[model samples]
Target: MLSRKNLEILVAAQKRLYCTFPELPSFEQRWDFETDGVIQALLTRLGDNDPYFHPRYAGHMSGYVCDVAVMSYFLAMQFNPNNHSYDGGRATTKMEVECLDSMARMLDWNHYQGHLTSGGTIGNLEALWIHREMGANTVICSKGAHFTHKRAANILDLKYLEVDVTKDGSLCSIALSGLLAALEATDVPVVVCTLGTTLNGAIDPLDEIFSLKAEHDFKVHVDAAYGGYFYLIRARLAGRNRKAFDFLPAADSIVIDPHKHGLQGFGCGALLLRGVSESTSQAIYTHDSPYTYFDRRGISIGEKTLECSRPGAAAAALWATMQCLPLEEEGEFSRVLLSCHTAAVKMSELLFAVDDVRLIVREPALDIVVFYIECADISAATRQLYEQLKASGFYVAMADCDISSETGVFREVSCIRLTLMKKEHLAMVDELADQIIRLSKCIADEYRSQYQAL
Candidate 1:
C-alpha cells in the first residue's frame, strides 16, 4: 500500500536540501554487513503487524498517512532538526507556527497561541498544567473522556472528578451542573469536555457546558484529540455533532491530534490556547540554555511546552499535508472527513438490519460504529464474533459498555467497534457491511451448535 513515487520525491528533496548546504563538508557514512542484516531482520519483524494502511483495516482510530506527509517526514529526517528552539530548527520552527496558525483559523479562533507536542497525552498534560498554574485546584470531566485526563490530574496533584454519562454516552449535563455548583462553593474547577469519546465516538454537549461556564467561574478545556478536525466538515455533520464544534472557539484550551485525523504520521499533537496573555504563557516558562535561543528574541516553544526536543519531522509532515489538503469547508480534506461520516452511517444501517446485532449507539456521532451481539451470553458472543471477523480477514476492535438494570445495577457487555477512518472505507462500506453480517451469522451458528452439544 506504500507509494514508490513518494519515496522518490523524498530522495529528490533530500538531495536538494543537501545542495543548499554546500559550504558544509560532507562525511561518508559507512555501514558494515551486520548492519544490513539487522535492518533486513527488523523489516521482517515489522511485517507481522496488521495491515493498518489497507481499506479492510477499519479496526481502530488509525488512519492512512497521505503521500505528501510521508515524503515530507522522510525528507525532514535527513536533517533531524529539533523544534525546541529556533536555534535548533529555524525553518521547522517557523513551519510549526504557520501550521498552528492554519489550525487555529480552522477552529475559528481569531487570536491563539499553540505548539506541537509528541501526542494527545502530553498536549493534555500541558494544558492541565497551565490550568493548575491559573490556580484551579480541581478538574472535572465526563466519564466518557479519555483516561489520560484523570491520570494527568493525578500527576499534577489536582482533584479529578468524573461526571456520569447519559444513556447515549454523553456527559450528563444535570450531573455536571450539580457537581460544578457544589464545587464552586470551595474551589475553582477546570472542566475537560471531550469532543469525541473513545468507546462510541459520542460527543459531550459542549454548548451546555459553555452555558454552565457562564453561571459558574470555571475554565473550559476541550479534548478534541480525536475529533477536532471535524470542524471543517461541521456543516455535513449531524446536528448534535455540529453543535459541539460550534462551541470549540469558546474553549480556553484545546488538544488535537494531527496523527489521528490530520493525515500525518504519529508523534504530532497540538495544544491551542484562546486569548492567552504574556503572563499566562509564562506559566510554563523554562530556563533557556546559553547555546539555544541565542538568535530568537521572542517566545520559544520549549519555554511554553512540557516537552523538549520534539521532532521537526512531524511539523514538516503536517505542513506538507496541509499545503496539499488545506483545512477549509467543503475542501478535499473536508470531503474525505464527510465521507467517513457517511460510511459510518452506512455501517449503522447495515447493523440495524441484522436481527442479532444490537447497536450501542443508534447513530454514530462520528466515524466510529459500535454494536453488540444479541445472545444469552452477550460477552462471549461478541468476543467470538470479534475473533471470527479477524480470522475472516475483516479486522475490528471491541469495547465494553455498561448496561444498567432496573434494580440499579450495572453489567459490562462486550461490543464490536469499527472506526471507518480510511478514506477508501467510503467505497468499501457495502462490502464491509456484508462481511459483518455473514461473519456474525457464521459465529452465531457455531455458538448454537456448541450449545446443543453441551
Candidate 2:
C-alpha cells in the first residue's frame, strides 16, 4: 500500500533540488508551480484515465508502478539524461549495467551480456535478430507466441514457423518435437518460447523443448516479457509452469519487461544473452563511436544494442525499484507477487462457485485469470459485460483471441482476462468475486432462453 509519506518526501526533495540551482529570472514566467488552475487541468485529464493503481482495475498489464519507482523516475526525469552512451549518462549507464548484472546472475548466467531496450518488442526483435545474424534459417515459436515474433521474423527476413498450442493455451511440446524432427538435420533453427502469452498467461514448455534442442541442434530464445520475474517464485507456480521456468537458464537469449512485472512504468525492457561467445560477437559490438564514446571507460550500451538514445531515467527508476524490492525468492517483492497469484486463485474459486460463468483455463497458470459468461453468443455477452464491469468499478481485460475449452463446453468465445497483479487486490478478492458472480448471473439469466435452444 502507498502512503502520503511518499508525496511528502518528493516535495522535500523538490525543495532541495531548487536550492542546488540559482533561480533564473525566466523561471517565474514558466507555468505556475502549484496553481489551482494547473492542478485542476491535470486532475481533469488524469482522473478520466483507468484507475490502474486500484484493485478494481483487474484490467490489462498496466498495473501500478510502486511509489519508489515513480518517485525515482520523476526525480531522474529532471536531469533528462540519455543512456545512449557514457557521454550522455555516465552515472545512469553504470546503474544500468549493475542492474543487468544483477538480473543476469538471478537467471544463473555468469558471463551474460545484456542491455535495456525501449520495451519488450524491441528487446525481442534483437534476440531473434541475433539468432538470424548467426545464420539460423528459421525462427519457430508457438501459435500462442506474442504477435511480435512473426513481425520480428519478417523484419529480419527469416523463415518463420508457428507450432500449435495445447488445450490449456500452452505451446504443444509434441507438436514442437514433430516440427523439429521434420526440419533438415543440419537446420539449426532458432526456437522462440513465450514464458507468458499475453492473453492467458500460458507458459511454453521450456524444459521439454530444451531436450529437443540438444537432439535437434537448435538455439533457444525465451520471450519472458511478462513472466520473467515469476522465475523467482517458480516453486509457487503450477507444475508445468514451474517446470518451464526451472529451465530458464538454458535459453540462449531472453527478453523481459521491467514495466510489466518488474514494478516500473511503461517502456523498460531488457535483453539477456547467455554469453558473448566468438559466434555471438556479431551481435554485440563495441568498435569506436567517435561521436558518443569520448573517454568511454568500457563498452557503451548503444554499441551492444540496436536502439540508440534510450532513456536514462528508465534505468534510474528500475534501479531504485530494485533497491526496495531485491529479486530474491523470499523477499518483499516475491511476497507481493505471491499475493497477486493468490488473488487470481481466490478469484477462480469465487467464479467457480458462481452459477453460469465458465472459466477458460480451469485454473490460472499465473496472475491472469480468464473467464467468460456461458451464453449463446459469447462475443456479444462478453463485450457487454466488459463495459458493464467497468461501469460498476471492476475493470478487466478482454482477450486478444477467442478462447475455448477442450471438452467443447465453451466454444470459440470472447472471454474476460483479469490481470490480478496488485497486492491490494488480495483484500478486494471477495468484493471483486461477488461483483462478477452477481453480474455473471444476471448476464446468464438474460440469455437463458437462447442457451436452452442450443
Candidate 3:
C-alpha cells in the first residue's frame, strides 16, 4: 500500500513538471525542434540535481553561461557509458583520451600523460600525489596559490615553503632564490608554481621558475587550471611567421580544468605529466576479483584512479565540446578564448578608473581583475562593500585573509575578484564601476557622520 502511495505521488510530481514547459510559436517550434524550450528546461533541472555537481541556482557564476554546460551534461547522460574499461566503453574513453591529448599539446608537452578528475581541487591533489609518491618531501609556491594546493600538501604529510609575491601578485624570483639557498642540503624541495591564482587569477612567473629546473634538479608542476588557456591566446595574436613567442613551456606536470576554460560542465579536470612512465603510474591492486576485470589488463579503474566509478557523462561532454571548438593555426585552441581575455582587460580598465578604488592587480595575467578601495579600516569597509555589491546581484569574490596576511597585504588591503568569461559581462562592468563609486561615497559619509557625532 505504501509503494502504491509513493507511485501516485511520483506521478503527480511528473504532471506538475510537465506544466512548466514554455509555449512557443507553432511554426518555429515545428521547424527547429532542436531549440525546444521544454527539453532545455528538463536538462537544466537534471544538471542541478546530479551528485558531484556545482549548482548554479539562477545566479551568475564566473561570467559563464552555466546553463549551456548543464544542457551538455544532460545530453551526454543519455549514452551512460562506463568509461572505466575499453571493453565496456572503448570508444568513449578513447574520445576522452583525444580531449586529454588536445590539452597536453596546448601545454606544449605532447608526450605528457593525464586523465580527467572531478574538479580543479582533485586535479591538484592527483598531481601532488604523483609528484610526492615519486619523491618530493618539500613543496614550494607563492603565498597566493589556491588553498587546495596547501590542503593537498597537508594531506600528503609534506612540508611546504611559501615565498612572497610582488605588488602585482607574482612570485618574487629573488625571494625564491634566497629561500632555496637557505634550505639545508638534506631538505627535499619541489617547486609547484601557480599559473593562475584563484582569488584574483594572478599568474606566477612561469619562465623564471622553469629556468630554475636546470640549476636545481627539482621537478616543476604548474597549477594552470585558471590560466592555461591564456597561452593559446598569446600564440594567436602573434600571427603567422612570428618566431619564438612568449609562453610557459609545459612543466613536468600541469593541472588544467575543462569546466573552467574548455566550456564544458564541472567535474572535469586533467593532470598532464611530462614523464609519466609506467613505473611512476603503475597500477598496483591487491583485490583480484575476476568478475570486475573484463579488459586486456583485467584491472578495475578504481585501482588506477583516485575515485571509483567517475561519471562517463563528464568525459563525454568534454569530448563533445572539444570537437565543437576548432584549433588555431599553431595547433592551439580556438581564438574565442582570446575574447575572454580581452573582456577581462576591459573590465580591469573600468575597475581601475573608478574614483578612490585602487586596482590590486594593475595588469591582469588572465581573465581576472582584483581591486579595492583605499581605507584605514579595511575590514569594516570591505564588509559593507561586499554586502552592498551582493545585494545588487553582482557575484564577485573576496581575497582570503590567510593568504593575503602571509603576503603582507591582508591587513592593509581587502579586495574583490572578478572573472570575465562571457561577452555579456562587459555590459555589466560599467554598472559595477558605478556601484563601486557609490559604495565608496557611502562609506565616506558614514565615517564622517560618526566623527562629527563623536
Model 3 gets an lDDT of 0.65
- The true-versus-predicted C-alpha distance at residue 39 of model 1, in Å, is 2.0
Error of 3 at 353 (Å): 3.1
How do the residues 126-202 of candidate 3 rate in per-residue lDDT, one tens digit apiece? 77787788777788889888778789889998888899988767678789888887887866787877766776666
Candidate 3 lowest-lDDT run of ten: 50-59
Clashing pairs in 2: none
Ranking by lDDT: 1, 2, 3
Q: What is the lDDT, from 0 to 100, of the residue 333 in candidate 3? A: 45
TM-score, candidate number 1:
0.95
Error of 2 at 213 (Å): 2.0
TM-score for each predicted model, relative to the true structure: 0.95, 0.92, 0.76
Worst 10 residues of 2 by lDDT: 23-32
Off by over 4 Å in 3: 1-69, 235-247, 283-289, 297-303, 327-335, 400-413, 452-454
Put down candidate 1 lDDT per residue, 12-126, tens digits, no spaces. 7777877877888986577655687889999999899888888889888888888888888888887888888877887788889999999989877778889999889999998
